[model samples]
Target chain A: MKLLESRGLLTLALAGAFLWSLTGVDWGSPLIHTGGGAAARTFFLALFPPDLSPDFLGVALAATWPTLAYAVAGMTVAVLIGIPLGILASGTVVSSPALRLPAALVSRFSLGGLRAIHELVWAVLFVAAFGLSPLAAVLALGLPYGGILGRIYAELLHDVPPEPLRALRTAGASPMRQFLYGRVPLALPDMISYTFYRFECAIRSAAIMSFVGIQGLGYQIQLSLHDLLFRQVWTLLLFMLLLVVLVDQWSSLVRRKLAA
Target chain B: MKVAAVTAPAATQLAAEGIAKSYPGVQALAPISFTVSPGERVALAGPSGSGKTTLLYLLAGLLQPDSGRLCIEGQDLTAMRPGKELARLVGMVHQQFDLVGSLPVVHNVLAGRLGQWSLASSAMSLIWPRERRLAQEALERLGIADKLNQRTSKLSGGEQQRVAIARLMVQSPRIILADEPVSSLDPALAEEMMRLLVELVEDSGKTLIASLHSPYLIKKYCSRVIGLRRGQVQFDLPAAELTEAVLDRLYDLKAERI
Candidate 1:
């Protein structure tokens, strides 16, 4: 009976997904175009022997700074906004029942609203509103990233061991005091690790945001691709990969130190 | 040692009147009343699920009684907010050694005084630990002074337990509530920990209320015993009067069924 019940549920879920996919998609179209595949293969082959001209290299290096700066600035804003919102959403700091529910609901709703819009969509909206400034890209990255970080932060706070928290409460520590001394210290390592992961995501998002006229590696890649300069595109791609690798190395070092 | 009559009208160090606690489906602690004088060592002894932990939590002001009153140092607990004053008066040693494992031993010990410090001071201490000497002294008393800079997770179970005691020593509360503090230790370690705890409380003239599983340890260290069964106090007697027959009766499943 249980097997049949689970199978029925699985069937329903698959049918629902199939129905959903039917909207706005042309099912009659060929799944792959042979000509497009050849072009993609050509692009892949051009990845080797990338453009290393001094002028283009200088441009790539300059673009690298903007990408890193946007990510850092956006993440700085995200951390500032996320930590407080996460604490509010976690509902651990408040003791009074009257305040806890509303605080949790409001903060959670705001987080959901922010992250519901993808960073690219947010960038388009900000560009419309703010007229293509660096602020538009930064805000676009900050809002959605803050929402994701806040949600994860709330979960980390909630997932901490209750024994130490209970012992702090028993020692007559106030709710804020308990949170600062007992809860935050215990959750700090996990929070730092998650933030680093988010920072890597933010870098990728910043690169993508350049498509909306922001100045970064993505903009350079788009311009090169438009002129059919595959070599330049490959060079820009290499720069992006190098940036990600450096950040990944740094993150692992920090996490290893935390563990030790 | 003076054994003040349990009914003495004079204000005691700790008092509970009809204190009780209940969960959705279980009565974890039934309404019971007791008093402890200054400088007394009391042991709460019971089988599993006999409300020993519940009672200790209530006394520590961690759990509010569904229906009763508690007074610590003659101040009503229910009327006042649990904060620095209450923290300064009551400390608890948990069975699980609830120190932050990633933090250094000195930081964990210094956390004992967090309630007493201003928010600014507490925040500053995270970067530049204030009162390092006090924390060092507490660790010295526990014979783990050299481990002060070591991360708490690196310590053994016994050393971690001693770090917990060092934290309590830094707290310097007049009343200490220990919830099965030695439950995780071996027999020899448990005995030594209990003896140290009793001696510390006695030397400082503090009130000690500890929930203990070992009848032998209770007889050896505690001045009084409160035997609980099924959320109620079955017997409250001087240690000398808590004989083996009393324990047998206290733990008898056959008698409980009847």
Candidate 2:
């Protein structure tokens, strides 16, 4: 009898919660959300109606340089900072209990904090600090990518064979020597593959940063959307998609070759 | 004993006095004393959990004994930095084979020289074609010269063991510590591996202390054998003196009287 009563009360609570959700829900908002297949449908209905607005395309082409530059620059700095810091963060490379624990803690928290904030949020902060320039995009991209790359690098460094390290140590190889010889070579392929993957992500991130007055393909997409020229927006979207696809293919091919 | 007359045992490659280790629930090794002389082929024969592994770890400087001293070449191992300096004198092969499976056979053999190489050069793989030649030589010595370019995973169990042996050959440490070096092989391959190990150690003028389960093989290859039971050295004697009575006692299995 008590079990039956409990089931009745549980059902009542769920019904109440469902009714409450009904009160605040705006279910229709999703129907018109930007790029929610509505604009996509409008875009395709125009069917090869090319938005070859030379003026707009010129602006996009001009912004393309900054987009490519920021992504490349950001990735280079991210990799440079990430690799060494990642090695330091990985206890396998340190092998000292006194320093390893604290270094690991710092690395985890710092990287976690960097990752918690989105690149858009970072761009806003950098724009405010540096006053709306290409530098803002670079800084915005660097932290998040560095955090990602560092975490991956640390994991790879830790996972490599300890046998080689032991062998090196026995041969009187220094800790640095052991890591360089034993750990780095094993981790190189994975790192390169992941970095290329990140480069793809950085391309998108660079475009997003342009909304804060920095210029890229994203800036063009945002402008086209604002003007309600859905056709032009599709072109920018196509370009971004093409870039992502190319980077994805390149990463896989490179990884395969490196593995070979 | 006058100062001029006092001469320590220079022939002794390793000496352990009162080495002990304990985990949370169990004592791994307890107050064990042992020694290995240069060119001596010794076997540590025991069942699982007999402290054979712990003893091997202590001798190889892979694990620190909670209490005791380990001396190699009259230099105190426990006194130096934990894995850093202790590794120089000891070459160890773990039971799992602990190989870099993706690496080529020659690269794995060349891994023995990682300790000898510098950080910059090691990263660059700048040890040159000569290093590869040396690795090839080591592989040749172990009769796997053709497998130099093949991935280590492509090799069979016995072949992998030979690759490991080749790595040890390149390491050229004063003492070689092998844990269950032939436990996974067939009887013939096991015998062959043991024979090769013995020959290599003898040729290099180094001491070998191998942990194993097979008493027959121990008797055949090793000059001396140490029997362990429940973290204690149950017996330490010449291989010829390891009688059936001792085996029965160590294994705790009674003989069937016909």
Candidate 3:
């Protein structure tokens, strides 16, 4: 009875809050602008017949490589940054009660600070500081991705079954040793799987950087969209979809092999 | 019975004085005092909520007691920093076996020596496991050398227990604690696991404190049996004197005997 009451209360509160939030926009005003409906409909129609021209295919193929390269390179840097920071933030590596909380908090705050900024904002900032360069795009993607990965890695490390770690503790493995033998090994599968999932997100984010003059799939997407060549846009979107599908298949394969 | 360990007995094995622990509202353990000597095979027997595991945790320094002192060889465990000395002094086997299921059997066994290894050697060993012989020998002794490279979780319950015992043997701490170590296995496998563990402990002459469900196994292996009820000691008797009458009271079994 108590459980149902609390659950019902929570549901009501959420519904009320959602309804309240809807008031922020004026419902009387038409949400779509003049001709917007036609544009949206045309965009949807183009999906059925994407451009198959040989030259556009070549452009998409070229764009695909750089997008893939940026994602891999950016994720490489993110993982490098994430693993070390994640270890520190996990509080598993720090045994001293005095330091563990503060250390975790600082690392968590740093991760939060990094992750708080959107990837697009980071790309703009990096471009402003370093000029329009591939390195800038990589850094922009890597920093936020690293923060997200580090926070998740820390959570994974913490989520490891305490019994194994406790057994290690009683066995007298030092803090660092306990983490290496106990926590890290247990969390590895989940951490790897999550990293791959995050890498998929990074692929899309890398493509998005094209708007900031970082040439990739998104740059081509922008140009195609601007020229109102919706068919060309569909072709680019198809290529992006193919990339995501490939990554999805590859990651699942890796997961299966590990599980096996 | 084993006379001495490879690592010689410290002057005292472990002594707890008025040690107690409780969660937020419930007192898990009342203040309790006891001492365990080197080479002693002790069994902790109790009903479901008897605080046997809690006592073992306090002894292992895995959990801090709300009050009182715990010492191993006169070194206060509560204050002791974890390092080589602590690593060499104590080891534990959990009900779950506490093996990292994803890791291979060999790595789990070699993890016993992570404290002894230099940071460099330990790191390198992760990639190029140096002490294969030690791990192999422990597994061979436990009759599971074939399982050395196998992922730990893939092994059956009985086999995983062997891996855990093999890891403990490699650890070779002077004091060993087991919390229902064989509870997860079948009757036959449990007996076999118990026998192997006893043989190893006997050979090394290390202190063994196991919390057990089976009175038969407890009487068969332990020299001293401590019975607990409601977070307090009911009896701390020699195994011979741990008669059926006491067992009935310990477990609150009204009319059953085994």
lDDT of 1 at B35: 88
Q: After best superposition, candidate 2 residue A222: deviation in angstroms?
A: 1.7
Best prediction by TM-score: 3
Q: Which ten residues in a row are the worst by lDDT in model 1 chain A? A: A166-175
TM-score of each: 0.89, 0.82, 0.90
Of 1 and 2, the candidate ranking higher by DockQ: 1
Off by over 4 Å in 2: A1-40, A43-65, A95-98, A105-113, A129-132, A159-174, B1-11, B81-88, B102-107, B117-133, B146-159, B186-188, B241-249, B252-258
Task: Give the DockQ-based CAPRI class for model 1.
Answer: medium
Residue B54 miss distance in model 3 (angstroms): 1.7
Q: Best by DockQ, which number?
A: 3
Q: Give the Å error, residue A134, model 1.
A: 1.9
Order by TM-score, highest first: 3, 1, 2
lDDT tens digits, residues B187-229, model 3?
A: 9988987788788889988889999868789888889999888
Interface RMSD of each: 1.4, 3.5, 1.4
lDDT score for residue A130 of model 2: 93
Candidate 3, residues A29-109: lDDT per residue as tens digits?
A: 799988999999999999778998899899999998889888999999899889988988988878779999999999999
lDDT of 1: 0.86
Chain B, candidate 1: TM?
0.93
Cα displacement (angstroms), candidate 2, residue B165, comes to: 2.0
